[model samples]
Target: MNESIHVVCTHCHAMNRVPELRVGDAPSCGRCQQPLFQGQPVALDSAHFDKHLKGDLPLVVDFWAPWCGPCKSMAPQFAAAAQQLEPQIRLAKVDTEAEQALGARFGIRSIPTMVLFRGGQELARKSGALATRDIVAWARSVIK
Candidate 1:
């Protein structure tokens, strides 16, 4: 038998169990019938952040604020990283301006922080802007 993992839907934030081997085959959410990974970062708020953390796939969260220049400059690179990193990993963004509580909870002292989580636990964190290639490389390295 093949092992399976829980994948959270980017659209409805629903969790779906998918076979490990079939992850690349484009799985849909059982609850929402929507694609699980859309090659774009999911916009998350405090309400839905923990739910994503429960997923088996690693979650890379970009904590950012609108007033922060580096955060804005890194937004596209993060999104591009999502396109290259999805189906195996998930990328999300939290607007610190709107979710101040979350920023405080995560100890976000600076903007454009990338936090990686697996099984609802934080594994690693990176702060500052990085190019799309660097983002991919860093996430992969941390995951390994």
Candidate 2:
């Protein structure tokens, strides 16, 4: 049997399986029928966060808050990184203020922190804001 990839929908929190070779074709979720990668980071709350964590793709989350300047500055960079990193990775954002429990659970001490997860495991983490290239490089390094 050919290998398959498990992708959790950021739009509807649905789990989807796609053929490994077809991952570059912009697959949609079977249940929600939404594109799995939208070329942007998905905003997630605590309730929907764990669903992506369970997926097969590496999950890169930007933990940020509205009141933070650095977080705001990093938003566009994160979005650009999402456009560059799709299919191979899933990018998301969690509002620290809205999801305090998740921030605390991850021991987030600063705004604009990024955490990378795969197979429900924390692979790497970075704090503070970074440019799009840096984000892509860091994620690719961790994946390799």
lDDT of each: 0.93, 0.93
Off by over 4 Å in 2: none
Candidate 2 lDDT, 27-97, residue by residue in tens: 99898888988889999887888888999999999999999999999999999999999979989999999
Tell me each candidate's TM-score: 0.97, 0.97
Q: Candidate 1 residues 3-86, lDDT tens each? A: 999998888888899999999998899988988879999999988999999989999999999999999999999999999999
- What is the clash count of model 2? 0
Give me the overall lDDT of model 2. 0.93
In angstroms, give how far residue 83 of model 1 lies from its true place.
0.8
